[model samples]
Target: MTDEHDWAPDACTLPTAERPLRLAEFDRLFRDAVRDTDRPSPRRLRLRLDDAAEPVVRDLIARESACCSFFTFDLIRPEGDALTLDIRVPPAQVDVLDALARRAAPAPRP
Candidate 1:
């Protein structure tokens, strides 16, 4: 599986079997992709997925971000067979995250 950070940019595809892709697979892929060497960001992550997390496997758009105190999700692509992980990190902790992320992010691709 390709570790594409921009879930929106990289269109999700269905893995051969039945539905889309396993949620666990998505987690493994993304977690590996965003492996922070220094320390894991203190973001209150939540996967507010529309698809039923069950029998039917589906591709997931797992979010990893920093945001406002309470984040309200709007189902922009409800019909789309993809999981939505609305990652929300307290804004109060932005600066600390910036410092950490800057140091953690892979060297900018020229």
Candidate 2:
């Protein structure tokens, strides 16, 4: 069970015209594309993906930021091949971010 107070702001907050697709759909695809995750500290997380996914990831981040203004995202492209998405948030929002990280983590192999 969950209360309104316990809920995080979701895609519903955005205007219907602005949301081409639901957040859950984007998150599902995003999680599948994520290759790695690193948590340097309690307040920050770094998610890595191959170059091919960068454009979609960038679009996703843009939409996510519009709905969830509390989070700060930095996209870094290294010299080699991967793209890193660094996300930071206030301590109170860490739980929300953690949930996102958990969702984004790659599925385990059989």
Candidate 3:
């Protein structure tokens, strides 16, 4: 992730000391479970995750929602061994979403 506070918006209720821990949690999910990412709109982001990650995904999103009410997370389990997570933010928080998308992106191959 860029920085602990980079993607966090002013509306977030998470305490300063805990921001890095939360960011690390998100980074871990993106690195280990995220299979794909898509941007259907400026204010929305979609992540395809391994089906086995459902429990962790659920727990993470629930905690995230508690702290960041501006984020609207929708978890969908379609057929097959995959789960889709759609994240939406209001217009004012699009920048935060953008930062999250960047963080979720796969690292370049050397």
Candidate 4:
């Protein structure tokens, strides 16, 4: 069994209405990452950041991508010189999101 305790945030913390809109935004962001790529893996979601701050987001992204990790999902809000990735899962994306994310981030076909 997996640790069941990755770094991804709890989805329960978000208010109901705010969650959906954010998911939509996140969906758009994720789609843009692997756009016109190839087949996506069922366990990954690529976040397209306007400013990922180099190595910082990459580390967080790695943490979230670990297997059986619930905390892999995060919300990135960038303003001025600050960027915050609020780790939380949306109910809509719980398990299904991963597969859909793969569809969003596809691998290039040969």
| Model 2: residues with Cα > 4 Å off, grouped in runs | 1-12, 15-21
Which residue pairs clash within candidate 4?
A: 8-71, 38-106, 38-107, 38-108, 39-107, 64-72
Query: What is the C-alpha lDDT profile of model 4 across 1-110, one tens digit per residue?
Result: 11222212343344446545544544555544433322134444444444544354555346335532555555454556333333333454445444444434544669
- By summed lDDT, which 10 consecutive residues of candidate 2 come out lowest? 1-10
What C-alpha lDDT, on a 0 to 100 scale, does residue 27 get in candidate 2?
66
Report the number of the highest-lDDT candidate.
3
**Cα-based RMSD of candidate 3:** 2.2
List per-candidate RMSD values in Å.
14.3, 3.9, 2.2, 11.0
Q: Kindly list the per-residue Cα lDDT of model 1 for residues 43-110, writing each as its tens digit.
A: 53323333444222222332311112232223223464455333333565444334333433444549
TM-score of each: 0.23, 0.77, 0.91, 0.34
Best by TM-score: 3
Comparing 1 and 2 by TM-score, which wins? 2
Order the candidate numbers by TM-score, best to worst: 3, 2, 4, 1
lDDT of 3: 0.89
Better of 2 and 3 by TM-score: 3
